[model samples]
Target: MNGTRLRPATFKYIESELYAYPDYQREINKIRDEIINGQEEQDENIGAGKNSYRKPGRPTERTVTRLDDNKRMNHLKEMVHVVEQVYDRLDDTQKKMIQLRYWSKRGANWEYIAEECFISRRTAFNYRKEIVGAIASKLGMN
Candidate 1:
């Protein structure tokens, strides 16, 4: 796929939340890992990919400045803020569902979420759909 292609999974990840970890926590962990691992390996075939890449240093030398680590952290923070705003607008029941489904490390599974929310699995699924839709509308996301 092209760099900017909008895939179905993008919406899935946004709406259903793709991470097993708490929101923003995964990204924080990623930033930490990057810092510990140092710079990413250079893409040797700079101009050979679908997009042309101009070398930064000597014509033969390729230098990649790693600014995306910061961008990713900022994006994570913004998403967390939007989610918090939406979460605040939710009713008590919806908030309970979200907490059961997203916050607790052990309760962060569908079966556990259904159990904690005092609803059948099917009902939980439908509620999740509605809940995520409301969040999306509030956040202008997904």
Candidate 2:
């Protein structure tokens, strides 16, 4: 009760976030390969005159930016899987709360979760604590 610690809940959220993005990870590797190849080709043509440069083509600024964006998207995707796994064993209410807090676009908070479930904020907090503890125990990280 000291300083309102929610270490377990925070940990569960983080773990779930990590598990959510398997597809993103796979896509990331492919993007990385494209980026690397682009860079290599760019280097090869740097001093080979405009015509040679035209053949392999330089790595465009847009390509670099797109690759970076794809990487970030992949990271977010992975986090979604991690969150799903962490909340999988929770009760329906607890699962909904976690999904709202971590997955939903509106960025739901304890107050929102409480309102949606017709419970007090304190009750919502307790539910989060219980669900997180379960997650930690299941993952052998308790």
lDDT of 2 at 85: 69
Worst 10 residues of 2 by lDDT: 14-23
TM-score of structure candidate 1: 0.49
Predictions in order: lDDT? 0.60, 0.60
Residue-wise C-alpha lDDT for candidate 1, range 1-108, written one tens digit per residue: 112333455546655452332657767667756655666456678468657764555421212234344777666766776677767777776677777666655447
Tell me which residue pairs clash in candidate 1: none
Clashes of 2: 12
Q: What is the lDDT of residue 40 in candidate 1?
A: 47
Model 1: residues >4 Å from true position, as ranges? 1-8, 15-69, 105-111
**TM-score (all chains, Cα) for each model:** 0.49, 0.43
Best by TM-score: 1
Residue-level lDDT of model 2, residues 27-84, one tens digit each, is: 6667677765654533554577655635434457656766667756556554545445
